[model samples]
Target: MSVKPASSNRPLSPFMIGPYYRAQLTSMLSITHRLTGLALAFGTVFLAAWVTAAAAGPDAFAVFADLANSIVGKLLLVAYTWAMLYHLCNGIRHLFWDTGRGFEMKTAYASGYAVIGASVVLTAAVWAFALLV
Candidate 1:
């Protein structure tokens, strides 16, 4: 039985998408940076609302703070902290590259891996501190 290739000479636009996994670390990191940026944006809105409620009155503020200190809130805080720190550190790495430095292939990969490692380490540390305090 003769069958043509699955894609069959069709153009590969995102509009005609199929399973594709270009699992390169750099691409993964770039995508992750954008996702984390979105998380941070949502977190910021949550925080702003908390602050606004707090300024409204003691009762309103306590309610907001209580919810924020709940188990779910604590879990979210952990994730949010990591997202914030990771994005910040990665932004700094990019800023360095923007200054016409660290463009070497080895340096690029080294910095990318370093960003990943540091993000994990910092996330763990922040969660540990949250647990202790």
Candidate 2:
């Protein structure tokens, strides 16, 4: 005799994301934290290339300098700066979590928003200082 498989009305894992549960602020922030981490890794490579160019020769350094002074390069610099600040702020939040704090729903959401705000403000301050000096 053959046995029939059981059937259920439950949604699969992939379908649960949209229909069963909505994305929360905490979850979104967590995802952003991970992406910024990847961005930081790539940014480190760019920084290394710049340093290597400087050590190579004037011609090599000039190539990097020119790129750095260009519009696209400046935008990339701004993005990297933001990523650094965001990662740092989010990391501090994670530290608090590790200490068993900020676990409440309200506190978690507030901290997530604070991290984003602090990163943006710090990025602007750093860029402004760089431009002024």
Candidate 3:
């Protein structure tokens, strides 16, 4: 006769974050920071393409410019702008963390919110300047 090992219903990993866990603000911000970084990388590629098109000829430049001036393209530009600002603000928060600051629960949450607020405000300011002036 063989003895059967006991089976447990507990979560196998403490880091399992789906239905088993509630997400915290800091964690959400951290995830967003990473996503923004990736978006910035893609945006850089777009920028390079714009520059390449400009160098190629006026016709090529006009193609890019026309696409950029479209409604969908404008929306993408706004999103990219927000991503860039969010990444910048969040990166500053990270720098504070590197200095052994803003690690307290309250401080971390405050900084996360601040980063979000700053990014939104800065993005609006930038778009306003671009479109209005």
Candidate 4:
């Protein structure tokens, strides 16, 4: 008796889709949450450097102060601020989820959007207050 070989069927053309193809709000928020967490780490490093410089005396503090006043530095500061705010809001969302809340699809989406909106608003308000003070 002869045994038949197994058949092999493969697609003629296999195209790769984008990583975020048709991603839902929750998925997008999940990615953003991780990214912001990383960003906050870098931001903390910068903060630590600033504090260390301040402690090192006038000359060292002057260097950091000058950089902080530069245009690029200002933009980075803003971006870091937003990252912090976004991470904070998303963290609260996750906390709620941990408590067995916002598991529903609609509620999850709503909270995702709300987190984004609240982050923007909080960042803007804090910046405005900083500028005005």
Q: Quote each prediction's TM-score.
A: 0.79, 0.85, 0.86, 0.84
- C-alpha lDDT values of all predictions: 0.86, 0.92, 0.90, 0.87
Provide the lDDT at 24 for model 2. Answer: 83
| Error at 64, model 4, angstroms | 0.2
* Model 3 collision count: 0
Which sections of candidate 4 miss by over 4 Å? 1-21
Candidate number that wins on lDDT, 2 or 3? 2
Name the weakest run of 10 consecutive residues (lDDT summed) in model 3.
Answer: 5-14
- Tens digits of lDDT, candidate 3, 40-122: 99899899989999999999999999999999999999999999999999999999899998898888888888998999999
The model with the greater TM-score, 2 or 3, is 3
What are the clashing pairs of model 1?
none
Per-residue C-alpha lDDT of model 4 across residues 90-109, encoded as one tens digit per residue: 99999999999899989998
Best by lDDT: 2
Give one clash count per candidate, in the order shown.
0, 0, 0, 0
Give the winner by TM-score: 3
Candidate 1 residue-wise lDDT, 49-89, digit = tens: 88899789999999888988999988888888889989988
**Which model, 1 or 2, shows the larger lDDT?**
2
List CA RMSD, all candidates.
7.1, 4.9, 5.5, 7.0
lDDT of 3: 0.90
